[model samples]
Target: MTSCEVGNDPFLITADQVGKLSKETRVSQLGEIYKQDSIVNRRFDSTYIFGGNEIEIYETSGNQLLRLDPKTPGDTASRIGDIRILDPAFKTEKGLSTRSTYKEILENYTIKKIENTITDAVIFLEEIPAYITIDKKHLPTIFQLSTTHKIESSLIPDNAPIDQFWIGWE
Candidate 1:
């Protein structure tokens, strides 16, 4: 087995590391890195599509753990562009996970920005270089109706739960 396949905790997440995977880990190494887990690759039929290949990691018990997008689709050597943490078991050193609330995030990390999308509010964190998204339904009616409006931290309720958590290598 290679170095990538051994001695790395699978549940720990950091700014430059997630379990056995790191910023330098390539697409080809995923199989080895996740040898104990199940990997499902969903590639687009067309080669023209960018960021179309999504790789899912699942536990033996059939619980989805993560969704990874490669920097370049179909390129075995490509590093991970981004990773979406699907399981609440996977957490950062500070104990932030999918189940963490907006208030917990505020207490733990520095907020870089809050981006308003059609259905979600994506909050960027400076320390981990990660983003946590909250569904717009959790927001106030006025904030949910406008996608162009700048979403400030104070505008979000402390009890709002995170809908998605993503770590970007870039």
Candidate 2:
């Protein structure tokens, strides 16, 4: 594995890695990987609902950082299927974070596609295995409500801020 740091920081995100967690990091290794941070396992409830194997990582200061979902629920050996970045401190090497805007994203990476959902426009990046969402409120009226309508990247305002950012291992 390459050195975890990007510059002087270890929290930098890349296409194949997120800080100390790489594509090969497994569910069983979370505790060891985040030993300095707080780890919370959100297991399924008694109602028999299939709540996913979501593992939350928090700073010692009580700030949430990331939510990790394993590829196979209840399987300790499963690799991370998704990583939801919750803190703004976790930024891509290109400086894209949860706080980044569409313009920043466009300037830093190539857009693969734009998917229109009822409440948001999901922007997929070509250079990175990640996607960012812009809330419907930031979109033009025509593209806000209809899921059937395909949203082009050009339609989204450049200043629209990303509502959520997620990295997919799959």
The TM-scores of all predictions, comma-separated, are: 0.92, 0.91
What TM-score should be assigned to candidate 2?
0.91
Q: Mark the regions of model 2 whose C-alpha exceeds 4 Å error after superposition.
A: 1-8, 45-51
Query: How many clashing residue pairs appear in each of the predictions shown?
Result: 0, 0
* lDDT values, one for every candidate: 0.88, 0.86
Q: In terms of lDDT, which candidate is strongest?
A: 1
What TM-score number comes out for model 1?
0.92
Candidate 1 per-residue C-alpha lDDT over 1-170 given as tens digits, one digit per residue, 9 for 90 to 100: 35445336677888888777788889998887678889999988765765478999998889999999999887998999999999998899999999999999999999999999999999999999799999989998877898988898998999999999999997
**Residue ranges of candidate 1 with Cα displaced over 4 Å:** 1-8, 46-51
Question: Between which residue pairs do clashes occur in model 2?
Answer: none
Error of 1 at 127 (Å): 0.2
